[model samples]
Target: MPVVHHRCRRTEQKAEELTNARSKNRQMGPNTLLAHGPYDPHSLHGFVNPPVIHASTVLFESTDAMRHRKSLPYTYGLRGTPTTKALEDALSELEGADETILVPSGLAAITVPLLAFLGAGDHCLVVDSVYTPTRQFCNGTLRRMGVEIAYFDPHIGAGIADLMKPNTKVVFLEAPGSNTFEMMDVAAVCAAARAGGAVTMLDNTWATPLYFRPIAHGVDLSIHALTKYPGGHSDLMMGSVSATAATAAQLRETQMQIGLNAAPDDVYLVLRGLKTMGVRLERHQASALELARWLERREDVAEVRHPALPSFFDHALYARQFSGCSGLFSFLLPGGFKQAATFLDALELIGLGYSWGGHESLAVAVDLSDRTVAKGPKDGTFIRLQVGLEDVADLKADLEAGFAALAATAGTAG
Candidate 1:
């Protein structure tokens, strides 16, 4: 007879103990939950962080156990690992979701839920202000899969009910519509979708769960591009989908069947970032609001699209729904593409980048000409900025330089 190791017995005992304690720990506040809910110091020999378990094959001690792997905690790495579970649990707690699924990229988070709910002969209503990549996916892959897609104005609110088809299975939304920062009436749209028997999903990446709890506001499924706020460092790529108890089964099943998994290292990175996300986001929110206000007074700026600003058209709606804002907002410059290029080229401190939610600031020019249901800004060129942790005064000086470049370009054009 083979003797079992004492370490194995200790591990089993600790696992069982922690399993029983999870429900109690979940009742704690968000900050406590993010820091310690997912990890047990006793389980990992008093270590504060969970170990990165890079695994594919999980071995069983007995043939019977191997044959009945479905009863086990983890059967395979593609399904999940200890590292992945920690991140999922933490995210679920923050989002008020019954369960969460991790994916390779933020786009995967959006696409997976659509794939799970929609099939051939199904229709999906997507907001026109959705992320450009999401719009492309709906137009290309979902179209090829024989799913009908329609674009609706983000501000449609309760009017969304009139557009729902009998075959519509999903109503997708992104509040503070991508680039344009137009706020959607989430409760109104969600109520309308629920009446029509369509599942409601929102890309809550901008506000994250810290500032806006989507599930609490009637959203059925909440998605996050973890690459942005959750990751915080601009080094990792991951996405998460959180669902209410009633809808979690289908989402999990679809994810498993598709073999979607976030990398263990990236999962660990995100877990690390979550601890400091609260404070980092507070800084981001402050700097972004200050910059948005300053831009409103600029002669070169045509409009600022941050919802938190009192001057924003949808400020009332934003105030009603969101507890706080993040670092991202857009403004229109007084010139066309040429001036936009000049501004971008002249920036000294901010990087020209596509993604946001990093420690460093970034700037990008947006073109909304492709929008069919919503009109692009008629004033001039659209520019989006991600206000990072940099000093506000320094960032303002950088913008001054950018504006100077825009003026210089206009001078040359004349």
Candidate 2:
């Protein structure tokens, strides 16, 4: 009896500790939360990281248990496991969402909620400067499904209300938009959507939750390409859609109906990556801003489109919306595709690639012909840069080499 009393007392003490820890967690800053927000090491045999549970079928204790499968936190591997839940919980907290659903890829995150909310005869407004894949999906699949799509200027702001019809179901936004880096008036647009009884979804990948929280600003759904900043490494591919309490159930149901699931190992990688996102973003913000500013001063560069830069057209709006900037930005050279290619080919450190947010810097020559509203510089070609964690000085030197090669080639042509 004495031993039983002692064990019970110990249990009570541990329960108290856990409660206190959770209370403290609620008040901790972002960096601290990243390190120790949702995971409980004590609950998992003191393991620092949650176990990667690879599962498809879960065994039940009896017929009664199988009958009441819905009562269990997990029923099947594809539905979810403790591994996926850990990452989901972490992302939910980060994104300020009631719940977050993981998908196989970033584009899946964009499509799931879109497909869930919009149907035949529905009208959807997508920002003109959205990610290329999103535009393609809207034009192809969504349109083919009998949905009417309108591409609005990123700078439309409250003017979006003019375009809203009674059938308008979704307003999609991507601030500091893909390639061109055009900043949107997120709050104004969201407010306009709300007034028109439309749901607002923003692709928040460029400004991760570390820099911005869209839900707090009236966004119904916040989409993230976890393959980018959340994975931290270029090794994994995944996406997540975080929804407000009002929209969570619908978003979740859509994800389930579509049979969407991220690989357990990739989910684990994102979980590990979340712990260091704050620190990694800090470096990305600092280095990218430095590079943007440096490029602005160079005689060869025509324009630099980094929202964080004071000279940028939407700097004030960006300052109001985001806490900080990410490593992706673009600059322009005084020539078209050929000159851009010459410069990129000459670079030794920055690789020419499609994806960004990895540890290594990448550069791409952007094609702006697809845009209807946000046009790229006509006098020059835009070169998008994904400034990585490398020393800013080295990146500058590498860029200088590209400029030298371009100048030499141009002189030979003359």
For all candidates in order, the CA lDDT equals 0.91, 0.91
348-368 per-residue lDDT for model 1 (tens digits): 999999999999999999988
Error of 1 at 384 (Å): 0.4
Per-model TM-score on C-alpha atoms:
0.93, 0.96
Q: Tell me which residue pairs clash in candidate 2.
A: none
Runs in model 1 with CA error above 4 Å?
Answer: 1-29
* lDDT tens per residue, model 2, 161-233: 9999999999999977999888888889999999999999999999999899999899999999999998988
Q: What is the number of backbone collisions in each predicted candidate, taken in the order shown?
A: 0, 0
At residue 73, what lDDT does model 1 achieve? 84
Q: lDDT (0-100) at residue 361 of candidate 2?
A: 96
